[model samples]
Target: MKIRTIVFLTLFTCGSLALLVGSWLQVIPFTLTEDLGFITGALSVWLTVVENIWNFPIGIANDIFFFVLFWQAGLFADMGLQVLYVLLGLQGWYLWLHGGKNKTSLRVSNISPLELLVLVLITGIATTSLTFYLQTLQDSAPFWDALTTVLSLVAQYMLNKKFVENWYGWILADLIYIPLYIYERLYLTGVVYVTFLVMCLFGIRAWLQSRRAYA
Candidate 1:
């Protein structure tokens, strides 16, 4: 079978399943159509398969919808990160389209040593600061919220450069978020991230293969 055929089948299957779950959960307050978040999620996953730059647009849409939901849910950290994601998405689109030193830098590349170190350090300091501050603001589970927020910021920055490390960040955050969403009765979101977890694993493998091709 062609690789294209398999990819389409996988996306279709996942998307259809998410639709079913969304219908059952009725998680969104006023919609019977495909949940915007789930739809964008499936689009983002599909875009990852082709390494398309258009994932940024889908991600932006996903972030907006989620911003509203998270704000209402009082997941303040996640809510704030969704806004950051919009900015990050725009940055990623710009970078992907024109980030090359000579305006041609879209090739698959591994994370550089210096960049990785900086990313880790930034994540640590930002997470610590956000957690401490939010705790003072009486946010529930400030530490966990900060952890997800920091990881997501790191992931978004990496994504702007088309880095595969983005998936690793996403995987960790999704793992933490699945239970949190379930506890909050955000059943559709819980299921969405569960699917996102599986896709992140696939995305890592796919990006690694592309990295090897570049090598």
Candidate 2:
């Protein structure tokens, strides 16, 4: 295998093993709030690792897991986001396999200026709509949650298209999520978002490498 691939696998495997053992042994508390389940919490962190590596299949799995996780956490918007992630993930898998040159597998591609503009517009509209709806329902951190939710939706869509800008969106959302989950008292989940935020930096670098390879 290539050096980068080997390094990624080694780090991913080691980190996952350490985290899993820590959780099983109750080393890191394994939990921060009853707001989230152990498995759900575990998968959330796992999602960050796989996504950073641009692994779409595992992304699909974690997206499904989060669908259940967010639902149980009473995060209806996030639960809905998982549904969209799963749907788009399926499309992403197909595209990655068939959306490439001459109907071969798709390669990493850049977003056009038009798509970037659309992403911004979509973020604005979704955030506004969710903010109003959530406020009416008196949900906790409605604006923050709405903003992160919209950003996450945009990020997931960008990931589906293999757009490098997705990493930036993810970083923004993950930062917001840390405090949002903390407010919900899901401290472990909050920490997981912290990990996600850091991995997003690595993800940006990895995607940039991919872009360079294609360019």
Candidate 3:
């Protein structure tokens, strides 16, 4: 196996173990009523740090933790999105390896004005519809949860296609997510978003560099 793949697996195992132990000890709270635990929470935060930096492998880890945290917090939209994240992760990993012209490595691409408009329109519509469902059924922070879910769909899809604008979606989502995660008492995830907020800045810069280099 590749060295990066091994490392990714190691980190994923460690992170999962940490979460399991933390949950057992009540260190990682899975539900809204539960408070955060230290070790498991920290593991999750670190996983996000890894994911933000080198996403292909780390993305697998993220989908795992995200499923647990969002489910616990009643953020069903995002929780369900985690399943999509995993599927998209595989598609993204393959594309990154062999989706360029003539099956070359993938390079970052630009988002045209029309594409941006479509993404915005879709996200807005999805967010609005989901907000109503969440408000009525889950009584959760409907708008914020729905917002994250919708934007994540756009961001994840864009990233899979190697679009530089993907980071912008993450930055926006992370800003709203910090507060929303904390409100749900998924404090570790809240911290993770803060980390994502910072790393997304770096990601945008890196991808822009790739754009020039690959162009």
Candidate 4:
């Protein structure tokens, strides 16, 4: 890694640890698990923006943290989504290392129009079905939760394949998540989603530049 990247990661880790400590001590209003999820989630997105392979491992940790947090909050769909994220993260880790032409490192690329259409259709169907299922369980914000869940799944899959369009899906989901988290009284998590919304823009720009460089 470059010196600057190393310095950034070190500072980010230290800052996250400080937040975790503060939350644990009740100096911060968020729960320990929430703080952990926020730290890992934010760091993972930042690393993804830079196309860092470390994002996958950090993201898996983030998924586990959020799974516990969401389960406690009764966001069942979101809780289930975290399990899928862990699976996707592991796949992404390998693909980033070698899922390319002849076992080479993957390169950023665009999705085809047909693929985009298919993903949209799939997301819509999944969200509708999940929303109904969550409603049966009396979940709060069932539709919104299902929408974000499906969108995130598609985005993560696209990201695993190094598709430049993944950021768009993430941006959409984050926008929905911001208000949803706040509505659930997960204020810190809402703030994290707001940060995610910004990081996703950078991800789009960075990945586009990477794709152009490859070309």
> Among these predicted structures, which one has the highest TM-score?
4
Pitting candidate 1 against candidate 2, the one with the higher lDDT is: 1
Model 4 segments more than 4 A misplaced: 1-7
Model 2 C-alpha lDDT per residue in residues 1-215, reported as the tens digit of each score: 66976886587667766767776677876532222333343444344334333455566666666676566677777777777777877787777667778977655667899989988998899899999998886666778878988998888777766788888888889888988888877676787777677767877787688778878
Tell me how many clashing residue pairs each candidate has: 0, 0, 1, 0
Cα displacement (Å) at residue 215, model 1 = 2.5
Give the C-alpha miss distance for residue 75 in model 3, angstroms: 1.4
- For TM-score, candidate 1 versus 3, the one ahead is 1
Candidate 1 per-residue lDDT over residues 108-186, each given as its tens digit: 5678989999989998899899999988877767988999999988987887787888888989999998998888777
Ranking by lDDT: 4, 1, 3, 2
Residue-wise C-alpha lDDT for candidate 4, range 89-170, written one tens digit per residue: 9999999999999999999999999999999999989999999999999998999999999999999999999999999999
User: Which candidate order results from sorting by TM-score in descending order?
Assistant: 4, 1, 2, 3
TM-score of each model, paired residue for residue: 0.85, 0.79, 0.75, 0.95
Model 3 TM-score? 0.75
TM-score of predicted structure 4? 0.95
